[model samples]
Target: MFMNIYPKAYISSLSDVKADYFKEKGIKGLILDLDNTIIPWKAAILQPEMADLLKGYQASGLNLCVVSNAFNRRVVGLLEPLGIPGVAWARKPRRKSFLKAMDILGTTPAETAVVGDQLFTDIWGGNRLGLYTVLVIPISKKEFFGTRFVRLLEKFVLNRLAKKGVIEIPE
Candidate 1:
């Protein structure tokens, strides 16, 4: 289970992602998590730096799809202007929604990357579908009660993986 949740790379933030490396590896699509991954939980829009990075990535020819567990209105309102496709209430660690996002992005799992701050949801779901998984530190410590609970489990898994020398990145 721990191995299944191990991310290919752990970085401080989305900006740390080496887009060229993923592009070189044939990753052509991005399955993005909207909240802590792109902005703080209550943030209304993307941060300027984040917006710049995402726009740059898109301009590089990679398609992006937002796959978040947030309500449809929340995700849709945020991604609408970008015209990015998305799936909301996308129960993660489940294959269906992830698969749907990939399909909408027109890429197979092998050619896609899933980016988020959670191990159980983003990493597990992406790894389950054979997509490259990238884990970024959450933008803020604030979280809902359920996510706070999951974060405890995520910490345990991350600690174990670190002890096993799997998570070597400095984040």
Candidate 2:
């Protein structure tokens, strides 16, 4: 039960995940969360460094798709410049949206990874499908009220997982 919510790996930031690392892991595609995972919750656009990093990932032949719970307009607007497809208003941790993302990328679960900051949404969804999961630190302290609530539960689970030697937490 706890393993379902634990990420396969934890990194300080999205930038910590290198393109070669993804390739080395046989990751052919990425299902990414927009808020916090990609950009700060309140950020209107992708940062310059993030854009470059994403471009590098793309150049390495990895397909990318954004799966965000935000409205269509917001998700589309941000991802358009990056040329990445997105499914907005995706109620995550649900298999439908994740399966749809894999379909969009034309990749199987084993060939893709779900990357995000939230455990319930990203890690649970990915692990449920047997897709690799990568957890990143939230970009900023600011976030939605509901996400703030989930973070509390996530903290407890993370602590337990760390104590059990199931996952590593950065110091």
Candidate maximizing lDDT: 2
lDDT by residue (tens digit), candidate 2, 84-154 = 99999899988899999999999999999999999888889899999989888899989767777788888
lDDT digits (tens) for residues 52-147 of candidate 1: 888889988888999998889888888887788879999998999999998899998899999999998899899998998988889988888778
Candidate 2: clashing pairs of residues: none
The clash number for model 2 is: 0
Cα shift from native, residue 139, model 2 (Å): 0.4
lDDT (C-alpha) at residue 72 in model 1: 91
Instruction: Tell me model 1's lDDT, rounded to 2 decimals.
Output: 0.86
C-alpha lDDT values of all predictions:
0.86, 0.88
Cα deviation in Å at residue 33, candidate 1? 0.6
